[model samples]
Target: MRTAKRPLQSQASEAQKQAALRYILDAWEEALHDGIEPEMLANAALFAALADLIDLYGEDAVAKMTTGLSRRIHHGEFTLRRTAQ
Candidate 1:
């Protein structure tokens, strides 16, 4: 029996990783709204590590992740980094 190979583009790309990071941050925001202390920084770090494993966008992915993170932080969600300190 022969197995089919997956297409290269079908694999997780930098955009996909960035989208995932956005999703994670969104969830974190929701959690914050609900008074849950979600580990936003930890999750972001993990996502970054995972992003490094893929062969897609490196800096671009990080930039998107930062943007999403900043937006959430500005909106009063759980902060990954202290802004006023």
Candidate 2:
């Protein structure tokens, strides 16, 4: 019998999201330790590091990270969010 796959958002919670964000930050720190370029860090390098973390940590972790990013966006913590007038 086959089981249905749960969507990432459905599987993630606030705490899990925070943990994933922490993991991403840690990965960024590690990349800095290896002397990755700043511009690269802002682009593909950051994503690469995040992908490595997700590979090591699992899909759930990535989903949580996505959730955390979304929360930040919703709260206007991310630059893309619009400020209240």
Candidate lDDT values, in order: 0.61, 0.67
Candidate 1 CA-lDDT value:
0.61
Q: What are the per-residue Cα lDDT tens digits for candidate 2 across 1-85?
A: 2222333344578899889878877987899899997588788855776676566556666656666776786676756335687
Cα lDDT tens digits for candidate 1, 42-73: 67656766565333444544454556776787
**TM-scores for all predictions:** 0.36, 0.44
RMSD of 2: 7.6
